[model samples]
Target chain A: MRKLYTKKLSKKDQLKDLEARKETVQFLLNYSKALRVVKCRGFTFDAILN
Target chain B: MNNVEITDAVLVREYMQGNETALSKLINRHHHRIYSFIFSKVFDRDVAEDIFQDTFIKVINTLKRGKYNEEGKFLPWVMRIAHNLVIDHFRRNKRMPKFDNSGDFNIFSVLSDSDLNVETQIIKDQIENDVKELIKELPEDQLEVLTMRIYKDMSFKEISERTGVSINTALGRMRYALINLRKIIEKHKLVLTN
Candidate 1:
């Protein structure tokens, strides 16, 4: 777990860091989305339908 | 001729000549790294997948239209396309609330509000934790770049200046870190939640 040193952070800064961290997590979760998209492209729906 | 030994330019030419296999060969050769690169950006499986397909479709259309000019560097070119698509996704969905980081935001509340069941939520959280743990396994150099960029939210130029390395070196470390992370994910067969 990454720790944010909040002792020195102003409340506003703390909230900003929290928002940034949340955005990072959201971005990380999207990682596999690209992999699945690429993999799926390899399989042609035309071949299956035929 | 073995498709594997042919150059990217040759493959592009063959593909443009209605040789579908040539395109498949090109895709097979570069898909892993390209996909890994895009996955590192988007993180969501379905959205990344859509962009990946769109990138290639654009690649095909560009080739057919004789717009592809990068003779031997097809992978980077394809990645550029995927990166643009990710940017477009965010732009199009700018109004959608991606994450709530307010004081009232709770993991339980977020999970419960979603359509996923409790068990699925647990699994998803577990996978996210596992992914974070895997990131720690990276080399110090790679980890430093990834941490500063992703966790600290630093730009590559800032990271380079702070770490006493060239901007290219910082960018290269990030690329290697993503590639290594992708390898780890594949080796562990870790399934990420959509």
Candidate 2:
């Protein structure tokens, strides 16, 4: 529940933008996860089996 | 089970069994939320990334030793670990942290007022920075309560316990923080939301 103070936008406008913001957040979330796997593989491969 | 259906408890079991892939999958599922949460506190991508990695490493080590027994959402559990690491890192470094690596969250630190694409990202960063500034202006009591409630995600009841204030007082402080933030936003003529 990201409470935003969207006083400037009308209800319809707010809904439209909220969807976009949610998508952006979702994208960033995916990017972050990918980065972790890349980092983990670097250390895991080195720490084990070699 | 596919990674989506995999719960944190299940992953912990797999990780305890020394299943490397399971550990990787867990990281993939949670890395962003944890990273973003850390980035918010430290305000640096490189530092956040280091803390993020260290947190998972700690989790792995702890689980291997049969220690993690919390029964709730794994994401928040790992997030708390990352939060502690950031605090520890800050204490050890004894300086205002800065981003190190070139990553998505680190972009917030590198901009030279050019090459802006997503308006929402820019706006979100601006709002956060503004809110931080306003918080600094608040009295110590209000600031502390607000930080615990908003950033730490602690409840009013918990804040009252931690700060030795009544629950009503805790809620009052949060209300004041929001009012203060609203004033700051208005002063700068910044739109609060989309």
Candidate 3:
């Protein structure tokens, strides 16, 4: 009975890990997409004097 | 072996032997990380670029004078020099706190005074895009934490809450993210150009 209970718990842990990884991946994809549209304004040293 | 395959110590030796391209290669290999580190600290694109140029000019001059001591670890040595230059800039501007006891001297604290020229804006955007490309290589867990910490400038607690993880897990992911990113940079021999 104890062995079976441990196996069930391990499976639950694996599912939780998978869920976390999926969430993380979704966040990164959205963040990278957002980065594509972000604008920045600044000058390089070469451009400043020229 | 070609210049790219040569080790940093060997390149330094070749540079010392009066081969200008060897010096150029050495600079090209490490300039991106050094530049990004300075930019992170200063947050002023023009100032960062100037300091980046100055850091290398100083490096070349020091190498020519035979003053560079660290033989094998050129990048870290040069990074230290660049960091000191950033601190020196703040000191010269009188913006650095006298004691810095509170330890609140962050780049975000320094206000930038850059005019929004179109060309400059485009250049800055290109650099950011390049950085994003590098960051994209990180694992999902690491990528999420790193993006939040860096681009979003979010605290670990905020990141944990948003990601639904404990603070420790959030911090761990960030650490792994940095390690993974460094590995990717080395594996791909990425050269970030501005």
Report the lDDT tens digits of candidate 1 across residue range B57-99.
6776666555678668887788788889989988877967476
| Candidate 2 per-residue lDDT over residues B1-194, each given as its tens digit | 35458777787677666665677667666666676677667665456656766776667656655567858667778877887888798887777554455333555576656655698689888878777876787778889998998899999999999999899999998898878867767777867564
In model 2, which runs have C-alpha deviations exceeding 4 angstroms? A1-49, B1-4, B95-194
DockQ for each numbered candidate: 0.02, 0.03, 0.01
Candidate 3 has which clashing residue pairs, if any?
none
**10 residues in a row with least lDDT, candidate 3 chain B:** B96-105
Residue B39's lDDT in candidate 2: 68
lDDT of 3 by residue, B1-194 (tens): 35448889888887766666776667666766776787767655567777777777667666655667755898888898899999898887686443322243556445555776787788878868877898898888889999999989999999999999999999899988888877887788866553
Lowest lDDT block of 10, candidate 3 chain A: A14-23
Q: Score residue B190 of candidate 3 by CA lDDT.
A: 69
- Models, CA RMSD each: 22.7, 17.5, 28.3
- Considering just the first chain, candidate 1 attains a TM-score of 0.28
Q: Tens digits of per-residue lDDT for model 2 on A3-48?
A: 5453454434422311112333344334333332212534432132
